[model samples]
Target: MAARVVSPTGRGFLLLDSHPAGCFRSVTDMVAQIPPKAGSQDRKVALVIGSSAGYGLAATLAGLVRHGIDGVGVAFERPPGRRTGTAGWYRTIATAAVAEEAGSDFTFLNADAFADTTKDEVLDLLEKRFGKLDLLVYSVAAPRRTDPRSGTTYQSVIKPLGAAHTTRTLEFDADGTPALRDVTATPAGEDEAADTVRVMGGEDWSRWVTALADRGLLREGFRTVALSYIGSSLTSAIYRDGTIGAAKVHLERTAEELDERLRPIGGRALTSVNGAAVTQASTAIPGIALYVSVLHAVLGDALQSPVEQSVQLWEQLTGAAPLDLDEQGRLRLDRWELDPAVQAAVAERWRAITPETIAEVADVAWFRAQFRGLYGFDVPGVDYSEPIDPDLDWPAPR
Candidate 1:
């Protein structure tokens, strides 16, 4: 197989194809950054739902390398057939390869996590192999979900709740240069808000926890974290104060309820407010790409990757670092991203940026590169001209 170059199919952050080798290399590079720990005499087990990409993948890698824990990851990914596999599929393969190298037992299930049948499959696997779970990470990010019982499909939107919001965002011009553009998201209707909550909210997280408990799959001192983000006021109207925010509020409230419910076995549930990164989901938000690009310019080296944040989260979970909880009792892993100085700097840049000056004011190139990297393009060491096979397969889960 000759090296195949895969370009995104659509404009504005829509990637329809992925590169197999590049995705593997990117995941391996991330895994290499985490120093592997010696396997414990009695290794623990963790389950990461939606563990194919973004923060979920970071958390799974952290558990395997930094904490020496066996892990089970559940994700929906496209297998290689007429085209290359989804980026998450290759990344999962890389994760499993890393696990084998580190001598940690790992399993990857390619299935829809929101379905009850998937839940049953996971429960059976846990009971048969691991017996109990030490950690459960909920990191699903999808555009829509079908209710397992009702069979009703709920689709989420990114609009604000009340009035329309207009913000400056980035879009590529015909010449392929990052150009500034005004993007607007009208207010979400009541149904839209409700659907967003139903799709992206905490109901799925709650369901997973309930299923685990009912099956006696939760170990003593078990911990569960659902990844979250609370951006600054710059993106509040379209993000933090938008329909997605409403869903996040429900998620946080659900965390509180689950925390209380888990008190019997010393188990705990909390939401980890993670820092921003170039995720597949973030690419679709109206103003988030612009905001994050400016943030990268202002913060520079201080900006944390998803893996870095996950490492800190693991440290906090294991008592190696302090758990900085906000008044809402949610773990604050996004503290640095939300620091006053950082926001002020980002705001100043945001105000000065324009269609003509966006390239200079924000790190648009960095943003573009990172976005491309998500689908295994524009990576550092991967040679695009080299021949490689797109049709590849990884070992199936045991």
Candidate 2:
């Protein structure tokens, strides 16, 4: 018997192209798009926890190129069976390569952000080299975490409370047609919720902040932010009101405490409520893919990617505009995603969705394309037909 091969799947095992040019080209192009500003260069150094890809990578790159801030990133990713790991690994390598060409620091440590070992590494690096960090961005999306202090690992679950929640899930067929499957996830247990909170909640984020403060590695006026999402009412049952939502609520509360802790030093902690998109993490959710499908169709060109969203957040932070927050206190960056017109239009498509209308009403083609792009399959200017050595020689900063 030979080792089993893992291939792409729209709903099943989603395959990713090993093409390197697409991943590198996509980010370098975006970095060159931003013109440097005079005062933006004031932010000298930043630490991005969980900065492998998605919003974290975009934010790190945006900070480095757009604002001239050098970066240190933390992530834990290993290659698949015989292939390179998630696209993030390659993305980080590509980002570091770009930064190298520009002669900027783009250090990376492949270790669990929740572990004391990784924190110790950050402390040493900051003390020996950068001295202090002007910004800290926490964007880890993990299903499990081990307490650095207690050494006990916790796993998070996504399940409804009280009763089983049944919802529609979207998967693409071999011919790339959208197929709907009814999925009814079991209700979460009481202890499971606690574990979910323990893993996905703000403990690690708060820990990172306090550790930096303790080590005096945080610069004056340092700012830290974490990401969150509260989508429309359609996903409340599985998202904002579910077990993961409980963790987010705790995460928001922790941000309040962190804000208070940093206020005296002129630093601030914020949780940015973002829009939904296809990600390795979001695909596990029962209804988010379907929601995003309908959302993309309704919003059309108005939809923004993680990079665009991170750029918006960066703009808001560095600008003179007063900080805006919802009644619940998290920063509102999903206004377009949750716009009344967008949601209403999405709802109409949601109700109209059926096996036959998946292509017409929901834009399944667009959905599948985006998913493929996440792993470097659908990007332009890349020749995928050629063989690729997934073993990219990433610079080991550790």
Off by over 4 Å in 1: 1-5, 38-42
Residue by residue across 1-398, what tens digits does model 2's lDDT show?
12233245434635643345556766776576554644534556788898776678778777766666676888887754455566777778887876676567769887889998899988888878788888888998898998967888898999987788999889877877679989998999999999999998999999889889999988888888899888989888988889999999999999999999998889889999988877777877888888988998888877877777777777766653456688877888799898898899999999998888877888777877777777777776777665555656666773
- Winner by lDDT: 1
lDDT of 1 by residue, 122-220 (tens): 899888888999888999999999999999999999999899999987887644599888888899999999999999999999999999999999999
TM-score of each: 0.96, 0.93
- Lowest summed lDDT across 10 adjacent residues in model 2 is found at 1-10
TM-score of 2: 0.93
What's the C-alpha lDDT at position 3 in model 1? 47
lDDT of 2: 0.79
